[model samples]
Target: MGVFDGVVSALRSAGCVFAEEEARLLLAEASSPGDLARNVQRRVAGVPLEHILGWAEFAGRRILVEPGVFVPRRRTELLVHEALALLPDAPQPAPPVVVDLCCGSGAVGAAIIQQAPWVELHAADIEPSAVLCARRNVGPMGGQVHAGDLFDALPPALRGQVRVLVVNAPYVPTEAIRTMPPEARLYEPVASLDGGPDGLDFHRRVAAGSLGWLAPGGHLLIETSQRQAGGTSAILAAAGFLTRTVHSEEVDGTVVVGCLAAGMTQG
Candidate 1:
C-alpha cells in the first residue's frame, strides 16, 4: 500500500474516528519515512496526535503544545468570543487588561490577543510544564505567562485592573476522570482535569477570588460543561456578580460570564 493508505489503515485500526484526516496531518508533519513510522506507532499506542506534532490548532492559530500539557479544545473558543465581546472598542486611553487564569498552553489568552491585539494579556497556571508551554505560545504576542496556583500566579500590580478574566479551569468530576479518553487521562496532568468531587471546585475558587482582581464593570468568563453551567453561574452570583451563561451548540461549548457591578468594590 502507498504511504497514505498505510497510515489511514493503521489509524483506523486504532479507532481514530477521523483516520484519513489524521493520516494527512501526520504525513505533512513527518520529516522523513522514519519519522512517519515513529509518529504512526505513537498514535497507534494512544498518544495524542497534537503532542507528536508539537502544536494544536486553536482559535485559528497554531498553539505550541508540549507533551503532558492539556490540549486546547475547540469548545474553549467560547471563552475567547465572550471576552472579546466585553472589551471596549479601539482608541481607548490605554490597552485593556485581560487575564487567562488556569491557562494550559495559553491558547485561550493567545487567541484573545489575536482578536484584540490592543489588550494587555497575562496568563498563569500551577503546572510548571503548562506554564512553560504557555510562554512559548503567548510570549511573542506580548502576553506574560506566570507560574503559580490560580490567582496567585498573577502579578500584584494586576489587581483591580483586569478588564476581562477568562478561565478554562478543570471541571471534570474527580470520579469521572477515569472514564475520560485515554489520550487525556493517561497523558494530560490530573490537575488539568480533576475539578474536585463535584466538578465545581475551581469554579468556586475563581468566583470567590475574582472580585478583588476585576475592575468595576469587568467580566469573568469560565468554560464549563452544559450540565454544570447553572452551578457555575450560581457560584458567581453568590460571589456578588451578575451572571449569564452562554452556550454554543456547534462546538458543544458553554461559558458562564459574571460581571462585577460598576459601583461595587471588592468587599
Candidate 2:
C-alpha cells in the first residue's frame, strides 16, 4: 500500500472521522515519507487535527494555530456575522476600529478584516502562546496583536474608539473541565478553558471593560453557551449596555451582543 493508504488506515483505526481527507492533507504537508509517518503517529495519539497540521481553517481563512493555543472553531464564524451586522450605516473616510479581545489565533479579527477590508483590527490575549499564535494570523491582516489580560492590553488611544469588539473568551465552567475532550484538557492552558464556577468569569471581565473601549454606538459580541447566555447578557446590562442575545441553531452557537447605553461611562 502507498504511504497515504497506510496513514489513512492508522487514523481511521484510531477514530479519526475523516481519514481520507486527513491523509490527503498530511500528504500535502509532509516533505518526505518519514515525516509523514511521524505526523500520522501524532494524529493517532489524539492530537487535534489543527495542531497536527499546524493551522486551522476558520471563517474560510487559514489561521496559524500553535500548540497550547485555543483552536478557533468554525462555529465562531457566527461572531464575525454579528460583529459585521453591528457596523454603522453611515459612510466614513476611515475604516471602523475593531478589537478582538481574548483572541486565541485572531481568527475573528482576521475574518472581520477580510469581511470588511477597511476595518482597523487589533487583537489581544492573556496567554503568551495565544498571543504568538494570534500574531501569525492577525499581523497578515494588518492588525496589531498585544499580550495581556483582555482590554488592559489595548493602547490608551483606542479607549472609547472601538466600533466592534468581538470576543471568544474561555467560557467553559471550571468543574466541567473534567468532561472536556482530552485534546483540550491536556494541551490547552487552564486559563484558556477554566471559566470560574459558572463559566462567566471571562464574560464578566470582557463586558465590564468594553464600556471603556467601545465608541458611542459601538457593539460587543461575545460567544457563550446558550445555557449561559442570559447570565452573560446580564453582565453586559449591568455594565450599562443595552443587551440582546443572538443564537444560531445550525451551529449551536450563542452570542450576547452589548451596545453601550446612551451616556453611560462616556468620557
> Highest lDDT, which number?
1
Cα RMSD of all models vs. native, in order, equals 1.0, 1.8
Off by more than 4 A, model 2? 88-91
Candidate 1 residues 1-267, lDDT tens each? 999999999999999999999999999999999999999999999999899999998988899998989999999988888898999767377889999999999999999888888899999999999999999999999999999999988899988998899999999999999999999999999999999999999999998888889988889999999999999999998888898899999888999998886666473
Tens-digit lDDT track of model 2 for 182-248: 7788877888888899999988888777777888888888999999999999999999889999999
Quote each prediction's TM-score. 0.98, 0.94
Clashing pairs in 1: none
Instruction: Name the candidate that leads on TM-score.
Output: 1
Residue 28, model 2: Cα distance from true site in angstroms: 2.0
